[model samples]
Target: MTTNDPAGDPAAARGNAARARSFGAVAAAYDAGRPTFPSEALTWILGPGRGLQVLDLGAGTGKLAAVAAELGHHVIAVDPSPEMLEVCRRRQGIDTMVGAAESIPLAHGSVDAVIVGQAFHWFDHARALPEIARVLRPNGVLGLLWNDADTVVPWVRRISQVMQGDCQTVTHSGGGDRFEPMPILEGSNLFWMIEQARFRHWQDLDRKGLRQLALSHSAVAILKETRREQVLEQIDQIYEHTARPPEPLRMPYLTDCFRAHPSEFANYRRTLDSPVAPHL
Candidate 1:
């Protein structure tokens, strides 16, 4: 399978692709810096389904996959970056594949549920939606999750501002806007009955951990060395102003989740075309 670039401009498409692949360079930092999805959010997305085969689409460093496996779901984690997959491979019980959301390597109707974490916005959703629909069984669910900074706090808001800069490139590229309804899911005809949930969570991190988190962002990771250092220094200054050193800093987050089932008409067609007995 191949991804068709949705952006009309060649330069824009190239830039988007570069940003998507940039995380591989800081795969270790990404794994260490990123916050795991709240367990409550995961429970809500997966429901009470047991022993289900779940595909963690674009599963960076196996964060979501690890949690799913712990919940007794069989997980196949796929990503386009080998560097990210290398980290995922070290985690026991996660099946890692090198692939993208637009062109998943999984077979048709092979997964009971498909979950994307922090990477859906980077996909060419025009192509990815169909591919995702193809891999899901009838009535299978699609779940998208993002861990956004709880900027309701003044200090947290300031830190976020520093990290994002004037253009808000980091948030734009990193799937920000946790509170708003996802336009892609809303406009998509392939999925329906969308529902959303939010969970409040916090991560305790030291200065180094905080810096790693900032550096893991694609916008920050791709910066030239001098600019990157400047950004890090800014982040450090913000951290120092917000909290004392040697003490763990509390980073608040809102774990936003959206889950929906494949559209009825699409699933019906898939069922009719299935090799086995018709679902209906």
Candidate 2:
């Protein structure tokens, strides 16, 4: 069944597509404001390996792709936005391509692992999952990750509420000590042996950086001029109230990582002549 076009609210789908593409306009703020993935979190996703061909699908600004390359993997970063890919290209040791998850630009069985960072929710899973499976070699891995604010702290929780105004626009996986697995992965014939892990990390943000953080959000970036200004003003007030004298605010994040392998990897070799075995 294809999911690229679904029977749902047309307006909502259009809004989602618009929000998904909104980051390219504020690419600089996204790079500056967003926190990098923890090396340990990435290592866990890639499993025990080096020199593997890894594809960072839906990679934005190469945040996750850059870290994967540093870990000794041959990384290729792919995204739909050329503007975002431009920033990704500046980084060393990784190739950048303009592509989307629904239709990937790679050879069949070309990559050992495929990773998505904070971008899977934007994909049409029915189309993307099969495309992703097609590109993986035998026993390959697929990892999905998101970085969320640790809202267990009172101040941090308050900041989160402020950022999420009357209308919810930002999307987050999980916060604090909690991790919520995606419902899309629950019972799919395409994948199996799904596992999850979380890594704790921190980012230091000054007042200007805090504003950039707000601007980095798709909802805030697309807001009408006056309302956008109001949001920025609110962020400044929050910073003034939360900041300690002369020190940047330490923002904690819980990085949620999920990894799975194609069902074919478990019982079949993805060969045209090989008979598929049942998954046990």
Candidate 3:
């Protein structure tokens, strides 16, 4: 959820929004390139529960939702992009809706859990947090998931550098040594505690898949035709140098999962504040 730009920069904010929205144009590429969440991570996120109603907020292509559904939970997948939701709709056991985090479509206390996969960074926490707190049932869990390239590996470090234009490197979030509480969650007094877990996984990629991976990036996807091609070429060059013949390249990822529980007081307040439907 960390960005290289300063928080107060208006241009950076605009650029980030553009990047966030850029995925719809390359939704297919994103589905092909993005790795699925490890089952262990989802299991941990859901705790020891079963058959809970799960809402995959900001659910791009239903990656996390599909896994949650497979694990026996009914999943509601919500995203703002029609193109992305189209891909998500193809998945079984998932109900798709077009919505944003700032304004969730579900009723208050409607869902047992809310999971956001690789999309929490895009949210306006001030607004989204309250909406999230509203939809969550009492004792409901809020989970945030991210898959970061394990740059601790030597060659993967080079790939991250290439992806970020070689000027700066991507920083790991959630599972790093320093444990800083998220200000939005902590200050809101809606959540009682924050707990995190890390899982390791690998994605196998061929040359075509590698190209798709580069094309899927918002920063690269939004580039003009020629500049985008240049970035792809650089990425291909790295692939050629690092990848071995007859063996698919194994890209390592650290799936960082975080879960927070709603405070009893917050749940009680939301219940009291909720509007009732009129009796006919």
Candidate 4:
């Protein structure tokens, strides 16, 4: 099975893989610090579907899976990390499994839709695209979601800079390009009818919550002990200097959501090969 590690630069990709896996070490903090998906965003992705069988691929700590379950979807949550899966299992509705995006554990043509939230960038798209297409039914939907800080707000911009170390990390992390059409999805024949939407939302967080949020990031989570402490201290200073007297400060976000359906070719192929009659 192909790993989620990035390609091209071997050393950098290995470091990224290690960084990606580092989340399990701070899984609890991740769950606590991460903001949940907006209901409107979920509604847009679901698109009038009810009780759909949905797979949450790369579902770290069940954040998006929990939201999907609440919306009455039959949710299956999958991730590579056992620690992340453990947290997911604790949630009442989701069925948790240990699996990577490139090699989903589910049977072929089973799920009505596959949703990936905040983790699609880590996927090896060459392998994962085929796997995702395999499990999705004819005309099945593929949704991608990302919760990004709205740096247009000056304080939020400054805070993001502090967390990211520099503006380049923000750009490299797809902060600016997330809302645009994804190259992998756009260039592929597997998916057609691509659509995009942005939902505005904000989270109320205190100084401690802000610290946890910073720590929840892979870049921050992978930092060495003393360096991590220094980063947190910098965040603390930023919060102290900018936040008002109110205990909970407003942190704005833009939830970028994109959805696409299987291409006509994909649907036709599935129809010809399917053991059961095509649903679409």
Instruction: List model 4 lDDT by residue over 21-102, tens digit each.
Output: 9899999889888888998898898876678889999999999999999889999999999988888899988998899998
lDDT of 1 by residue, 77-146 (tens): 9999999999999988889999988899977788888998887767777778888888898768899888
lDDT score for residue 55 of model 1: 96
Can you write out model 3's per-residue Cα lDDT over 170-190, one digit (the tens) per residue? 232322322223665677788
The global C-alpha lDDT for each of the candidates, from Candidate 1 onward, is: 0.80, 0.79, 0.81, 0.81
Candidate 3 ranges with C-alpha deviation above 4 Å: 1-9, 166-181, 275-280
Off-target runs (Cα >4 Å) in candidate 1 are: 1-13, 169-182, 272-280
Worst 10 residues of 3 by lDDT: 170-179
- TM-score, candidate number 2: 0.88
Query: Which candidate model has the greater TM-score, 1 or 2?
Result: 1
Model 3 reaches what TM-score against the true structure?
0.90
**Which residue runs of candidate 2 sit more than 4 Å off their true CA positions?**
1-11, 169-181, 265-270, 273-280
Worst 10 residues of 4 by lDDT: 166-175
Q: Could you give the C-alpha RMSD of every candidate to the true structure, in order shown?
A: 4.2, 5.0, 3.5, 3.8
In candidate 1, residue 66 scores what lDDT? 90
